[model samples]
Target: NTDVTDQRSAEEQSRYLMGELNHRTKNLLAVVQAIARNTARSTMPEAFLDTFAARLGGLAASNDLLVAQDWSSVHLEDLVMGQLRTIGADEDVRVVVGGAPFLVCPQHAQVIGMALHELATNSLKHGALAHPEGRLRIVWTGASSANWKLEWDESLPSALVPPERKGFGHVVMVDMVERALDGVVKLEFRSSGVLWSLNVRGPGVGR
Candidate 1:
């Protein structure tokens, strides 16, 4: 009778672990699906492939950070830098990031990381980072215990005009990322450059 009880307990533990694995697998698949759909906007096959690959790399980096922290929370600075590094933003001397220390919940890190990836890619391709003299400044502000705001401001060359068409980058920032964080996003295109602002509420704040 003792042996049977021990065997049953082991089996139950195995079943529970398997169930948890399945759940996490399903969630991962869902996230990948969303990324695929969002990254399918490029008309050229090569462009699509490149963009998709970079986005996936960003997601992987975010996951790595979350895992390192036991999936509880990650520092906002680490999350930003990880995404930037994955997208090669570290190579640019003109890009700047400054903010008070804060924590990002695991639930929002992936989305926010992806959003930063998209922004950096856009800047490298068409925004400030595309030109030799253009510059980018990213700053965040808020009390540690309340909501926070982050801004991505770019300064371009004198003669550029705003894009007439909305691209995947725009959608990711204004729609997908904003919705995911349950926050608000504002993007403005001025002659100086593009300025993007994100306001995330306290509920989205990590412990």
Candidate 2:
């Protein structure tokens, strides 16, 4: 009777564990499906879906990094490097990272990751990365007043002028900077290249 009771208890535990796993799996799938549906219905369907999927994947990757760091804040440089890896960036691509490594909260890291991804994708499709002769220069520096400045300069001399209508990428970049990060973005359409400057106060600065 003891042996039979032990077997029944073990089976019950296994069944409960399986049920929990199934429930969590179903919830995850539902989330993904919702993301896909909303993305597909966006203004720029293709770019929206692509970026949405990529951002979701980036969040997963960032989560892994967070786990590795025991859920503590991550260094800015480490977060940037980890995100670049998700998009297959390397030394040969003229990518440069600068500034002292500051610890970034998880929420800030995710937003920055998405913003960076948008910048990269824009360069790849219509900016610097579109031409072999073009170059992309990214620089970041800190101000004494606790503000951070980031610049994205793309050298595409032969590229066409900026489109009259702003697309999804443009909207995402603008929203991430102004709304999400509470930053200011300045866009310049110089003859030599396109310059984008973002000035953001560090987290908790305004609030």
lDDT of each: 0.82, 0.67
The TM-score leader among the candidates is 1
Worst 10 residues of 1 by lDDT: 38-47
Task: TM-score for candidate 2, please give it.
Answer: 0.69
TM-score of each: 0.85, 0.69
Residue-wise lDDT of candidate 2 within 1-207, one digit each (tens)?
999999999999999988966874685566457546655665474567566878577656666666677556777677667766776764546566666656766555656665666677656767776777788777777733568877878787594477576554465567655776688887776665678777887654222
- Please, what are the lDDT tens digits per residue for candidate 1 over residues 1-207? 999999999999999988976886798789888778866854366677777788889889999998898778898889888877885777569888889888888878877887888788777877888888999998889937467898999999775577778877678778987888778999888888888888988856666
Off by over 4 Å in 2: 1-38, 43-52, 189-191, 202-207
Model 1 misplacement above 4 A = 1-18
In model 1, the Cα lDDT at residue 196 comes to 86
Best by lDDT: 1
**Clash number for candidate 2:** 0
